[model samples]
Target: MKIQRRTVNSSTDQVLDSDPVIDRIYKGRNAQSKDEFDYALAQLLPYHLLKGIDACCSWLYDAFKAQDRICIIGDYDVDGATSTTVMLKGLAGLGFTDVCYMIPNRIKDGYGLTPALVDRAISMQAQRIITVDNGIVSYQGVDYANANGVSVLITDHHMAAEKLPEAVVVNPNQLDCTFPSKTLAGVGVAYYVLIAFRAYLRDQGHDLRFNLLELIDIVALGTVADCVPLDKNNRLLVHHGLKRMRSGQVSHGIAALLSIAKRNPKLLASDDLGFAVAPRLNAAGRLDDMSIGVQCLMSDSAQEAHSYAQTLDSINLTRREIQANMLDEAQKSLETVDVKNEKIAIVYGEKWHEGIIGLVASMLKETHNIPAIAMANDSDNTILKGSCRSIPGLNIRDVLVDFDLQHPGVLIKFGGHAMAAGLSLNASRLTDFTEGMRALIQEKVTDDMLQKCILVDGPLPQSHRNLPFARLLLTKGPWGQCFEKPVFDDVFTLESVRKVGQAHLKLSVRDSEQQYDAIWFFCPESWFAVRAKQVRLIYALSINDFNGKRSVQLMVQHAQVVESLPIVS
Candidate 1:
């Protein structure tokens, strides 16, 4: 991948009171005023702006007053786990009794609030059912619940279907809902619901002043993990959550997961939550059951949460091994694929783990810079569960929707966000679906979408590359998705390099004047054969707080050889 500097934003000269580089970064991202950079809770949009929030809260009030059985149905990803924990923990804190939850099994119950799952919730004596991270397309499930006299409320963030479900829906993407930020994660929606309900109770002469901000940590984790665009509202949610974590006010489960992942909460940022903690939580769902993850997050005791974290870490290890093996098999299969003309990569393994295909699909997308689909035979052996991952400039979900409409019965069912989606089809129709998807994508995806380029913020000034500047960059904002963290490129003379940590390399390098410590994680085997004396590094500056001392450190993301020395015998 070639390095490309981002275009400078010339609309405004000064929008922030901080450093010039930070100002430029903000302006380039289209920040027009200081308010867009604000991360305060007071800046969050009001819940009343959501179309169905009042009705949803009113229904919740009735459930709380009657002490009716409330069953929350959650998905199996990190967002789902955290959303379930937020609603369960939040409502229970608000003095609601007999609240329970149900997470569908990936192998059995499938995605969303299925009719079978609704019947199970009914059998559990649930009077109300609330779905987190899903249920927008679950028309049959909502119909079944409505027919059975069980009230259903869906708080989702996915794009809406043409017709609505027969439930109290609070999705910001609803046709007429005027919520300002449409990119909320499922956990963010769940948080808003409880916040609105809490306010409603207070207005009804009942002072149930539940600490709403206490759930920000879970909200932050889910928001970052879901990979939603970090708009202004989401930045506020994550900013306060990171603040609480840094101050040691965090959930037992998250803290334990951080400990196991070996991340320092003092130096934590959004990527740590996404890379270290999110995968551990997601592994529970991929391998066995995600309830293990939700229980971990909701655990009251530190010891218990740590135990669950250990189990999750183990499952993650197994997941990694399975993914690596599957990728190897998939890559071998790709050897015969027509790389020049292929628009979508479709790979399948009969014995592959259904849940792990999503991970493989993501890795393939990153490695190939193309949309990828990984399919695995379902337990029934007649069906294939497929996971789709796409690059920017292409919405994979839209592709699936078009494919489903243009040629029906090829897909058993499909739903998801723009960049990622999940689908199932008959094992016999794999070739037909793959070819059809490729043909459709051939006409839709552009050549620019297939190219991989590394975007950087030009070169970092030598004067500003210091401990204080690095510290400010880390804590000044919680960045992700649409709002990106900054990385810069510069040439450096390599003094020495050696292996450290797990599959990592630590380097001592210097620019023209100053020396800095740098590290690269999961270094490729090709690095061992490097005889390069100088290289251009694309890196992020960070803080090293080891042994109670602080200094600037370089976290290298990509490196290209600029000068190579002769191989000495």
Candidate 2:
């Protein structure tokens, strides 16, 4: 399949350039400077989604005045954990103490606000049930809460259904909302709700003494972990969060997680939060209960946080083992079937654990470079629950929605954003559903869309791989999703190569003037076919701090050997 290359002319690619002006715009830290902050704040002046915020704030203030017992129903992932933490801490700062949180267990309670969870909330005698990161599509759950005389206020950023939930939904994706930035993570929306609550308290002449900006670290952690686009608003949230984290003002859980992962807090970047911190937090939810993770975030004592961090670290190890085994099994299953011939890769196993289907789908997508879905049949019933992960330019949610429209009774329920989603169906419909999805993809996705390529910002000299250069990049970044850390292209001559840890290859690469060591994770051994030739490399700059010494490293993304025609060179 031929792929269409997306290229911008040199003169027109201003935003992607490494120039000072472009850097200032994309870095988003200039918001800390008075002049730049004022200028940027002026651009946000026309946004008026604060009206719904005002309504949400009024409702919360009334609940506070009446001394209502509030229960927060949070999702189990990092975004949900951070969102729950932000709300718990934010409300406590507003002098509201009658608050408790419940994170749904991934295995038992499933995702979001289920009827079972709503019943649990009622059993706890909660007057109000506030949802973080979830509850946007939980129509039946919200109805159960309403029937039980419980009010619900939902703060989320997931894609909404055509028929909204019967609750005070405050998602920016709501049809009525006109917020300029629509790319907020669940934590970002939760923070905004708190901002509105703070504004309401100020209007009522109340003193709120907590620093709201301190929660930016949580927001940054979740936003990057969830892979949300970092627009202006999200960028602001992450920038401030990265600042506080680097300044040593982040939660003890985060600090301990970083410590356990051997990541240096002094020079942490956004990737550290996404890859190092968020996964450990999510491991608890994936393997056991998420309460362990939420407790880790909410704990103030370093000792308690360290204990939870250790538990989470242990869980992450177990999760790695589980995922490795599952991926191997899934790949073996793929080999028996003709996955290469299928337009949409849909594979299922009765023995596949539901908790790891999302990871399996991600692996399939990476392996085949196609839209992939994986399901695990429920042990008790004929129902199967699945998760999906998509490539760029493909909207998995929209595709599912289209599928639902075309084939009724096939999808029991599904909801999510453009790139990822979750769904359920009867086990009987699996074959037809797979065929329908493949036909849909073959009709929609062109041949050119299948090949994946690395996007390099520009070329960098080998001399830049040093401590001083690494420090400069680190200080200049609070980088995440869209405004990513710099990836450069270079031509390197390979000196030596050997497989490390089974699949990864460790290489000693030399350019014209300097040599550097690099590692490519999960690369195939066949890539060493042109070991002695110059190869083009795409990589991100990183600092490897080991045993108190730091050095810049190239985290390789992609590489291809530059071949010469016979006798043409």
Candidate 3:
């Protein structure tokens, strides 16, 4: 593992009106000017910049005017749920009465717009079909829809294939598109489509009775939950959305989700959406039909939303149990091999729940600091489906793409992003697939890339290490993905230590000036053997409110004995 301090260009000489700490953090992230930190809706890029939006909007306008029966095909993830909710709400607000949605079953229907999905849409008597969060690579599905006299509009953010679908595709990653921010999530793209649709309606002399900005909350949930880089546009969406959530101006579904998750909407942050709300919504897709999650998001009644949220919450708990058991099985399977010697970790089990394999793969990748693939026997015993999670340098999708190209027909189907992907193959071909992945990883992944790096924003001055500063940092702007939260590295002397839970260390520490309370979570009992009174710690300052009394605390990320220079200085 490597610990590196992020460098800030303090000499750039740009003055900021906000807190110096916030300004420094923003500057460290290469913010060109203070305006970059302004996430107002007015600062967002124009919807016209999204290449296919205008055309898609024109198509949607025709559908709306004709009162065409429309069906929305949504994926089963949180992004899909949010995107689906946004489209459903937006279309209804625009006075499109005949609109319904379909969420694909993860295990049965797989991903994206498919032929069977198109058939379902046709059966629904849909004259037009819109796909949210998916459909860019759905060539056959779009062909089927077009052949069936159903018009299709794709609003996706996935990487596009060389030959695109026949539908009107609005993906930023498309070859010919010039959207400034290519990393918009599927939900973000859907929101852009709504923006363009609103513009189109306004041009056509239609008075919109509803405000579309109210849907910002849904877009914010999806954008942050999808783990897209928090660029300026994304930040703008999330910042405004967070404001709405905090003020209790969100939708019934969002309000219910917040209540069921035990999160105070008044203190909601981007992390809450990613860690708490999104998982509950995603669980419905992972373990069962994602329609439950989507319905929860789309429900207008508070009671209905709460009921759906509770159901999703229960499913999420089951998902956690299944994920834990699968990860345990995966680790036990890896014990036979020298994990350090392997370039990639490939593990599988018979009858392992297919839905939870991706979580296991991610856990394995994080734990071993290596590319990992976790496979499970599909419904058909002759085929095996696997999920791949990759390290920073390796693009897992490209690996699968090249492998499929090199050995045609080896991969039954594959899709995903740089860091994660999914594929299926013949059961007998597992050995060949493992070797191919290992070889491919060896060819692309560097040794340094395998090492985990902890990035710190230099040392925090003692002057700024108080309850006020900690609270300010805690309640600050949405931090996620590329725009990371502030973390600092400094030395502290352990004054006292106590066990908080089964695997946690609560400590009182002292620096040269004062003592601070700190907590090291998930620190196993065995880690006490390596503990030291004087240690260098990488930590984030946070405010902990207990019984309405707020105090500063250091959330320790990593610590080492102060015997030598810090690792990777």
Judging by TM-score against the true structure, name the best candidate: 1
Clashing pairs in 1: none
- Model 2, stretches more than 4 Å misplaced? 1-48, 528-530, 563-569
lDDT of 2 by residue, 1-569 (tens): 22122243333333432444334434332233333222232343232373367668878988999989899999989999988998998888888879998999887787788789988888887899999999888888999888888999988887776788888888888776888787888888888888778877888998768878767788788888888876666766776777788889988878888888888777988888888898899888888988898898888999999999999999999998988888888888778676656656887877888888999999999889888999998878689999999888899999999999999999999877678999999989998898889988887786666777655566665556677777777665556677667677778887777778878877788877777878888886786444556776777777778788776678887777775324433
User: Regarding TM-score, does 2 or 3 come out ahead?
Assistant: 3
Number of clashes recorded per candidate = 0, 0, 0
- TM-scores vs. true structure, each candidate: 0.96, 0.91, 0.94
Per-residue lDDT of candidate 3, residues 92-158 (tens digit): 9888999999999999998889999999998999999999999988889999999989999999998
Which order, best to worst by TM-score? 1, 3, 2
Candidate 3 off by > 4 Å? 16-18, 474-476, 512-515, 528-531, 563-569
lDDT of each: 0.90, 0.79, 0.86
For candidate 3, give the lDDT of residue 330.
Answer: 90
Q: Which pairs clash in the backbone of model 2?
A: none
In angstroms, how far off is 133's CA in candidate 1?
A: 1.4
